[model samples]
Target chain A: MRDKTDKLRRIAIEPVTRVEGHGKVTLLLDEEGRVVQARLHIVEFRGFEKFIQGHPYWELPLLVQRLCGICPVSHHLAAAKAIDQIVGVETLSPAALKLRRLLHFGQVLQSHALHFFHLASPDLLFGYDSEISKRNILGVLHKHPQLALQGVKIRKFGQQIIEAISGKRIHGIAAIPGGMNKALAPSVVSTLQTSIREILPWATQALELAKQLCLADRVHFDGFASLPSRYLSLVAPNGALELYDGKLRIRNSDGSSYIDQFDPCAYDQLINEEARDWSYMKFPFLIAEGPEQGWYRVGPLARVNNCDFIPTPKAEQARQEFLALSGDPLVHGTLAYHWARMIEALHCAEAIDLLLQDSELCSDDLQRQGQKSNEGIGVIEAPRGTLFHHYRIDDQDCVETANLIVSTTSNNHAMNESVRLVADAKLSGREITPELLNLVEVAIRAYDPCLSCATHAVGQMPLKIELHDVRQGLLHWLHKDQRGDFVAA
Target chain B: MSGMKSAFSFDGIQIAFTSGQSIMQAVLDGGGYIPHLCYHPQLSVHGSCRLCMVKVGDRYLSACTTEAQNGMQVENQISELRELRLKLLEMLFAEGNHFCPSCELSGNCQLQALAYELGMTHSRFPLQYPTRKRDGSHATVFLDRDRCINCEICVRASRELDGKNVFSLSGRGSDTALQINSEDGRLGSTDLIATDSSARLCPVGALVFKQGNYAERPNERLYDTHIISETGNRRPAVVSGGYPELGE
Candidate 1:
């Protein structure tokens, strides 16, 4: 058999930087200088499911949060919802439900705001092709100090909401099996009430800035790494945008509906996950579509496109303008994710403002009683997309089996496809350019793919772009680390 | 000591106790600290965990089992004894499936609190991930043998305090097991009520009220604010269902 690597020159971008955790993108080009294959590889294989088998069922919400640093709250809520079923509580108390919803809004708001303003802005404000040193959060602070300050305070406000209710900013113990652990203190509600007044307007400004940036470069923005594929998210019973709890909505590339109200409990029957050799992340597809044609997208762009309308007034107005950007039923541009994310941030801020006013939040009637269930499935729209946590417990209340399809896992196929399309369209020869890296990286970055996304600064990874001939190996390499300057390693 | 005198100096302080009193009881009465688990004052002494090993003269012995004597010169915090106590704590940690972060007994656990007070960072030995079974069939109580230190406090409590004889040890040495003396070998089938001393006497998170986690929040849990050595292993005011039980 002939070795396939004999003819292909590999342009390997090891560890795409600035997103939580990291991934590698490899563009394989044949001797004719044509891009042959593009693959995004996630090497991490966290055995949380297998290892968590024997833990008490209630510890799941706390345990699964370790899966994602950026969106632990999403995992926590998702697992808690599943446990609610296990413990047999059909409906949480009004007070319990409101506190959970408030926590979810805070999570979505902080995550979306941080993603748009802190991580994705530098790529937009300073053009992608700009030098790496000036294309970062620091650079945004250097030129647009006021905008940077708004991003910081808005994110802080969102986190403050989380801290107020959950006790701490992350990995907090807010939701118990049947209900929340504590009532939201009136003082905390008052403090958050004061903070949201400033955040709502700032969220509006961020949304406008995102919309403006995309408008400035319509041609590039509309087409960069864009792909037409299916979209999936959670929507309210009335077909409105819902992030915390709702039925599943799957839409076609043309904005036509596939299934609008699939039961979350039957997610395993609706979605089929296929494992591939190249990546630890599984490729999930609709049961009807099969693996080849069933690949779909889930995240900000998908959520925005799949829903009828966002519930909050300001965000609903923003969504209408977003939909107006295209004559087609849905917007497929990957860059539009930032614009949609900011819209959700505004909605979260509004939701928090609305939730804080509910007097039930201060009620002592927190817990609900229920019958015991053996299995449960929970689904929620994390800032990234739909997160599913399904668990089955033994009679002893130990987690007998667990199956999780985090938002990033659900988008694995789409992220790979987006980057592949970009590499195929942009790659001409063996040469690797900053513009090419920008487009390929931005494709996945738009997903804000939570690859071990840690906010820790102590161990920021070095990015390596390698040119390799499979036969000779390691032809040339360029490196970028915490110093933010590219070096020929 | 209770005024019965056969005086012994502990850490350069005179601690007087009756001839038949164990060193642990004397230490307690003398207002001195010696970290211990499986040595509750309310339960019969088991001396299973060697955590309270102290050097008397040239040999170390379990303080709860060793009787107080005149001119004993027992040392609880000597270099040899401190290292040995830490080794014992580390062994218990390694032998069990004790992921304290996930364990409901976390801050309230005497084993955990004692480890914290001793300044233990990590276990030197690799964890033995035993195939332990957790029993949650009981309506209100849970039994997770993963965190069980084989102390037999539950066994003693059930027989001596609750008068149920619902628990007993079934194996020997490292393989020792807590057998629920029920027709189906389950706690739910046994006469072990949630309020039974057996259900609450485990020093670790081996047994606990099923819905008791995060009841007082982390900051208010038993050992959260008070060091186990200083607080003498007493629990914080009990909070059930997010409300502190009245009449404390």
Candidate 2:
């Protein structure tokens, strides 16, 4: 099918669905029907930095959470931390810090559980080449009801934690400049404690399921989208796994450390973002490696690989089992993202349990005052990976400039690379079949790219990639309203 | 200003007020709610928002501007006036940007609280989408003209309470807007200190202090927890943390 009269034909996946935000994948093929290039395009740019420039310093946390519905807590906390710097509060009260940490862990927990069970689980539970009609969460419910229930319960548990701390299931404000707005009530703590009894076991069960599925079929899972470059995440001062607060650490693919104990505020010196003409998203890279080789990976895979060890007991036990996958220090298997993500989810659940017990969780010392500063930066390990929020406020206490590197933005280059590898290997010379088109979607879903800003932009076709057996986008990348039952690509 | 007191039936109950008390203020002081945005108890009645439009006999008058006469049957919950006020409220929303979901004053904004009080599900009118100016030039306050309903409560407060006359209106009709009284038309250039007595009484998100934007949980906000009838005409006190500061 000739879309354009040009020599190269484009097989485009307009609006990759089952992710947080909108994204697209265009596979350019030569006259021979050989896939030559693939580009994951974030068609829309929200221009949040420019939108946030004129806002007051305190509005940063409240305003920036409009970025993504899925990971607003990450944005909320990151912006709050940056505001802390603007307010010149270096350390928060223990209660405030604890509340913020609890919020972050909840964000990661629900996000990972949602990605694995709601979005990515169908592909894991059912084979990649399985029937499009039966390869979804519904299908999982029919086949593996217990596992599916665990996934839903796990996601709910995480969201409940968020609500307990932030006041809402989504877009609730927990963090404020220099502290937290509210502390958990004693009743709320008791309620969370009641819910955790059921959730902790479910989280471990979910992790065990992910581990067993991957380990049983190691060969298929390991090599699927196995294009490793480097990894980056936030770790504690003592080199322990930390999600909420930590220093930036990067590890090379070949058992070497690119950087360690890197100050997050000075990330400008360590990282650089390169813009290309094909995509709206900027490819961020390590300043040491440069753009050509510096494109690194973030999120669960990177966090698990880069961190020295997990802090919580159950997650640490699971991490030990996951690390024994190979003799090498790092796990480069792309599909292991699901496994690594569950490990983190387990850690978050356990952490939530421990935090619920802490007496400081209900303390009223929720805020502190400090002298003000002009510039501030906050970094944290979001569910997707490292999220950075930097701002420079004018003397009027309004934001003059805002520099944000969201988790999905950081993984732009890595996703594109993964798409390219999968397309080149599967669709280069072979006939483009229905199952083959889905393989491309499967590869992209592993990274769980948010493509958040595209929906906000005008004139961009917001199509959904029905890879989760939603009864659409099987043969066609973008479906038209044909009178018939289906539209073929 | 007469010393004698008079009674008037508002919505239902006969609320007693001293002579020269506006019907809106009397209903408010009598623990009754007639949805309003611009009418602050401490400020002079401007009757700009038109949200307090009530049926007084055969005429529809803004309750704040209308004086409460003895035995005057004022209809606060009449269908015609309710529908008219609904449209008026919709116009107030359309004429300006009042995106409460993202607004820092979502739960605290008097305009938002009244909308909920009036059961405003959606606006029937098309948004004017006027290109409004925002003044973040102030050290601690933000002047977002987009969310301004042109109520001019700030104008009255600045003139009457603070005696600063720092806020005033500039245009007429469609072009009417609140203008910051400074050399460059910027809030920063004025004598608008963050601690000015009348600084935080704009009744909207327009004149917002730049601290603790989202300090309260949704259910814990003023409007979320209490109806306008229950709270009367007071802006919930704002605290350093996101909780509302009460006069402890």
Candidate 3:
């Protein structure tokens, strides 16, 4: 018989699935069943930083793209821009600049569509507590075949554009140091223009679905991992929404005025990274606020919250409606990340349409050559958030040092905070069910953290959850089995 | 050299070559496929990769070094040879850090193309994850030893073609590595230049031109659309001697 005095217990989840990389969650409980600590643990280590040291600076655009298959263009362009700085090119040629922008729009569109349709819609369309097998993209296809087809088409269209411009969809080779290595052929441009026009309505439907989900579960949306934190994003020179390149902007948690604005090259002066023992990912915070008080958020929700205006008309309409949810400039609900992602997808489609119409996109003058310098920093807005690539070169132009602050890494602290919040609110002394444990993951998924990019782990994301007590041993261990069903181990 | 040329059957196709030419050379000269890594026409055959193993009678021999005799029947594309080559390619992939996506020579990389040609989806062997050095000490050349298949093309090119012994193989077995000729083992201290034959001799991303990296868009590279076997038409012209014509 079990002792009545054995009050302490523990819970653990391992090998989390349906995400981009390997991660786990651990929960510690006190004698009274109150949660003491909850943490997200990134288990894998990819030595991209260590391996890139001896390579040449010019190889970084290609080297860093290997960091994540889903968003290689973000890293490619970021490394290129940094190299551009090292080459001492103040600005890219007009034609090269437009082509790079077009590539970025394609990247964001594809990634957002993947996250929304493949990962998030499963939980939204089916109830969070529904049968695990039915809560996936396949299930979405089984019930809503047309919607599933649209999702696949949307993602394919974005991938096609990437392939047409660069070469291949996964690790394309187009952007170079000073500019792009190639220009869009007239034939490829015409094909992309037609595809974008056909896909805009589907993007709008995705936005509508997100809005419906948000309205249907207002209470859950309002409280699910909804914590007050500062928002960070990139803004154009005119204070408009910018994804590919822009000035860094910060806004306080209460929908107040701007905290700071600075050039992306000067990121080190404004933002600082704090390394934690549990995870390979580093926590980035505002330099002035310090680590304890400086925890901020980036990504879709943060981008929508911080931007003054989105330039595209349809996206702007979605943004205005999203802002009306709270009647304030900032929306703290973590679930709203799904809504923000859909809105960004719409914006990307509209931006692609506008760029395709530009005659300069078809120009043959692609890249420029320049003198090399000693140091460079490139920053761009990845689908997840702001990505920074910093490099220092030797006299021979070989990379002496490389530092990358990916978008998911920037949101590390806030993600941990959200996990703690969800676990604290949901798991009190009751028996932990798969449904209860999934709520905790919903909080982490809301950030749409790309552990592959954040931890630099190769391949698919595997997640696990653990619950523990102070005196007792591990109470429960839950994780996705080989068939992707959440099973107790 | 003999005045009479030898004719051989390679994978059911008749190939004619000089008496002194090896089976691999005959196959390449005839534009037939037999995967090879170290056997450059301009360099001496190393036969280390063993990817060009072919069935002759009941036994197998390295095609790159085995001479093509008159009426020699070489089973180049048989299932046995194909399986052996696939195993060799898989071993090479597991033995090195061949992260294709991040590699600068992804589409143009000969090793990658050969893998695709052989229908190699993934490596079956356990990855060694060896810690290899990347030497960017050269002013115009970048040497990532991690991707080296030890084809010895650079070694032979430096010694035989460029007349500058800039590279050599060191150690043995798993610990074996490509070493530079400089006292400090740095390319910057060597006489090798960007235009040197040794610099362009690498069949992989191991030795690459620093400035020209990714200059040709990936889609337009040598092996993007077509496999290495189909690149016979695009192969650079071999001059009067054995060496390929320079600056083609």
Q: Which candidate wins on lDDT?
A: 3
List TM-scores for all candidates, in order: 0.91, 0.90, 0.87
Residues A116-180 of candidate 2: C-alpha lDDT, one tens digit per residue: 88777777777777766677677888998888888888888889878888888888878877999
| lDDT assessment of candidate 1 | 0.79
DockQ of each: 0.44, 0.59, 0.49
| TM-score, cand. 1 | 0.91
Comparing 1 and 2 on DockQ, the stronger one: 2
Model 2 TM-score? 0.90
Best by TM-score: 1
RMSD of 1: 3.7
- In the range A330-353, model 3's lDDT, one tens digit per residue, is 899888899999999999999999
CA displacement after TM-score superposition, residue A418 of candidate 3 (Å): 2.3
Instruction: Give the Cα lDDT of each candidate.
Output: 0.79, 0.77, 0.80
The CAPRI category of model 1 is acceptable
Please, what are the lDDT tens digits per residue for candidate 1 over residues A1-489?
123332221233233433355455565555555555666777556788899997889888888887776688899999999998998998999999999999999999888877787778887898878766677778888899999999989988878877777667877777889888889778988888888899989999999999999889888888887888899999999999999888999998988898889898898888999998766688899888898788888888888899899999999999999999852779988888889999899999998899889999999898887888889888999999999999999878888999999888888887777877787788656567767766666677788636542221222324444445444443444445455445664
Ranking by lDDT: 3, 1, 2
Say which candidate scores most in DockQ.
2
> Model 1 off-target regions past 4 Å?
A1-20, A30-32, A453-489, B1-8, B12-19, B55-61, B69-80, B236-248
- Model 2 chain A, poorest ten-residue lDDT window? A464-473
For model 3, the DockQ equals 0.49
Error of 3 at A451 (Å): 4.2
